[model samples]
Target: MFNELLKERLLDAHLEFFRKDKKKFLIHRILYAVIVAMLYAMVIMVIKMPIWLIGFPAAFFIGWKFAYLKLLSTKKNIDIKNSFLFPQFLQSFIALLPSSGNVYQTLKATLNYTPDPLDKELIKLIQKIENGNDRNAYLAFADYIGSSEAYMVMNMIYQFSEQGVEKESIQELERYIQNLQENKVDELIQHKMNASDKFGLFPILISLFLVIGFAGVIFMHYMTNVTDALNTMPK
Candidate 1:
């Protein structure tokens, strides 16, 4: 029950995270690990002689595909959600240009334009614009991407672009975002280094323990056999 709850919590967190950051690739790694574990269990259950012999490699290939499918599903969801915000950011950023193109005109141009993944999010903003909704609030995509630096930048941009707030406020926001992103990268690198160090120690320790334990058991069995043979040989 505890494990089920924990798994549910983790799935919820991943779903929530994928909803925000469409470009991240960690979801694939998780799915691959899950499928590998499933395949291992499946192999242990096969009863047929030939099938059991082949199950290991067969399960590995099937599990690889299963993992790929899982990763694709997660990516599709992320793409859909991220697509909802593309137009607004594109319009706002383009509007910063010296051209006289109005927001609607810019959106019309973009609708006909081929959208890259990042820019496709603008289509949702265009839909909101056409529906007479608040486009300013739609400009909050930058912060919605799950990065603190991105959120701060979007917040400042949202205030400026949506609420007709001061433009100069964005300068400080930019500086802050730069610093935050740098710090975040440093922290991530340090965390990976620590994880690698811990992982490196595991195989060596496990191998050493297994070797010593197996050798001791074998030595004891050999000694017992020698004593039995000697006792039985004379009288």
Candidate 2:
């Protein structure tokens, strides 16, 4: 089902952060829901409301938290995949291509110097090659990245490996890398603007909430005074 697929993806997204202990992860999630529900139940009891009302907000809050964590993990993965490392990776690949004897050697040389998740991916690609899955390895690397630009780069490399590198092909690959770098710069600027907007909005929201709280307190004091005055008057 669609929901099952979504849940699988969400779990996979957090795999690095949470590790592979499903039982531990489930226990933590359950504790989160239980603690949230208990807090909401306490608030409802204080307000002299029916206990059933607590269940709604508790369930809603748990769903919201799950969605928030899922989104956070997804953004983290995107940041890792689209890191400045990619530009460095492309540059290194291009540089190595000229001196390395073949695509595998070029990739192996690049792997020695590459970082983190990209290095992890290259390891998988190398394993696939060792297992005689060269064709699938290229496609798998593209899928692992989930990037159109990555797919293009991988495909280009595969073509070069098959038909031998051509001047025109290398030139085209360079142009793609240049465009990718430009896109990354634009994305970075947009991220900064978004962060600035969030920072700016937070203070305004906090101030508005504080003003409303103060007004509520003053209104309550005024109403209490009026009631006391009326009780002592001609009534």
Candidate 3:
């Protein structure tokens, strides 16, 4: 009924932004949920009710954990947001390239204008370029960005840095970065839409759970009354 992929992202995140003991907390939640499920089953058995009845309460308890997934998506959204800064950095690098001696210098100068994550990456990039590692520096930068468009932009920069490459490469990089920016916008929009759809399903799930719980209580009461009446008549 909902996207399981989002839940996987939360597991991947490990709740880094929220807790230092994330792994322990995650372990606790999982073990606790499992314990709760088993405890509910035992309760139903003791009450002489159908074991299948455990599914409703367990589903309600565990399913609301989708909320935990929603919180972790915040970290993922922030990561996707950092993707936008790459095009901005590309634009700056292209603009500074004309007066700069090489890609190393352009990357160094861009550091003055860059922000977090990208700025941090550029610092590493500049170090690698200074160490006489040109190709892999750009490659590592692209890998850090982790997208097809990112690899394309890094390749454009690699070409633009060559001694005899055409000046037209600058314009090409500019147009490509523009398109990349537009695509990133679309991606962010789609991401939010998917989250919205997931959130909308929760209310319906909650209502269904409440109805099942009410039915369970009524069933328990009826069985209790029937047992009492039979005991009075026979004994």
Highest lDDT against the true fold, candidate? 2
Candidate 1 deviant stretches above 4 angstroms: 1-144, 147-152, 163-167, 230-235
Task: Give me the displacement of residue 8 in model 1, in angstroms.
Answer: 2.3
Error of 1 at 28 (Å): 17
lDDT of 2: 0.76
Span of ten consecutive residues with least summed lDDT in model 3: 1-10
lDDT of 2 by residue, 10-122 (tens): 66545554354767666666777777777777777888888578376756467446643664666566656556677778878888888997788888899977888678878
Clashing pairs counted in every model: 7, 0, 0
lDDT of 3 by residue, 1-235 (tens): 1455334554544455444476666666676666767776777788887957848675546744644655557656645656888878887887888787677788899999788867887898888877775777888888777688888778767765665346687777778888887887888799889999999999999999999999999999999999999989955
Order of models, best lDDT first: 2, 3, 1
* lDDT of candidate 1 over 137-231, digit per residue (tens): 45444534544444555555444444543435545544554565466567668878998999999999999999999999999999999999999
The deviation in Å at residue 55 for candidate 2 is 3.0
Error of 1 at 10 (Å): 7.2
Score residue 46 of candidate 3 by CA lDDT.
87
TM-score of each: 0.47, 0.79, 0.61
lDDT of each: 0.54, 0.76, 0.74
